[model samples]
Target: MSFRNFTTGQSHGFGGTYLKLVPGEMLVYSDVFDDPNLPGEMTVTVRLTAVSVGTEMTVVQENVPDVIPVEACYLGWQDSLRKLAGLVEPEITG
Candidate 1:
């Protein structure tokens, strides 16, 4: 699926198909952001582990453009995680 602005619902011009999926355990995919700020495709791998109390998640992004600052990706992923948690954690506990 393509990435879109949450507010505008417009395509961000970056899109890719899923490379691998394993139910709740793992997801790996290609994401290409064809913007002036970001000009490359990166492989994203998200792995999940079940814990006694909850779940553990790890996200690894590779082949990111050297021109892109790491801090930008950090902030972007942090925001995404917050949004994701809001969507999933409630159902896990509620």
Candidate 2:
């Protein structure tokens, strides 16, 4: 089994972005406006892997998406959020 974490964020004034973090010292996605005037919100996602070595478990591999669509306006916030979530959580498990 694999563990996954998904996140989403939004802002009204400037813009929005997305990020994802995973195991094995991997960074899913990251981006910055560099301009203070580009105020916005961002979301982060994380995934953890487990490895067994001599009765010890550790992270093996991870996959992180890219942080893009740095729109300066909150236009496709909802649709984008849902799309991101879908990518993060393709299936539901109990």
What clash pairs does model 1 have?
A: none
Clashes of each: 0, 1
lDDT of each prediction vs. the true structure? Answer: 0.83, 0.38
Alpha-carbon RMSD, each predicted model: 4.2, 13.0
Residue pairs whose backbone atoms clash in candidate 2: 21-45
The numbered model that scores best in TM-score is: 1
Q: How accurate is candidate 2 locally (lDDT)?
A: 0.38
Let me know the TM-score candidate 2 reaches against the reference structure.
0.21
Model 2: per-residue Cα lDDT at residue 46 = 37
**Which ranges of candidate 1 are over 4 A from the true structure?**
1-12, 88-94
Identify the leading candidate in terms of lDDT: 1
Model 2: which ten-residue window has the lowest total lDDT? 56-65
Q: What lDDT tens digits, residue by residue, belong to model 1 across residues 1-94?
A: 4566567675556777699999999999998876767777889999999999988989898988897679968887898889887987756454
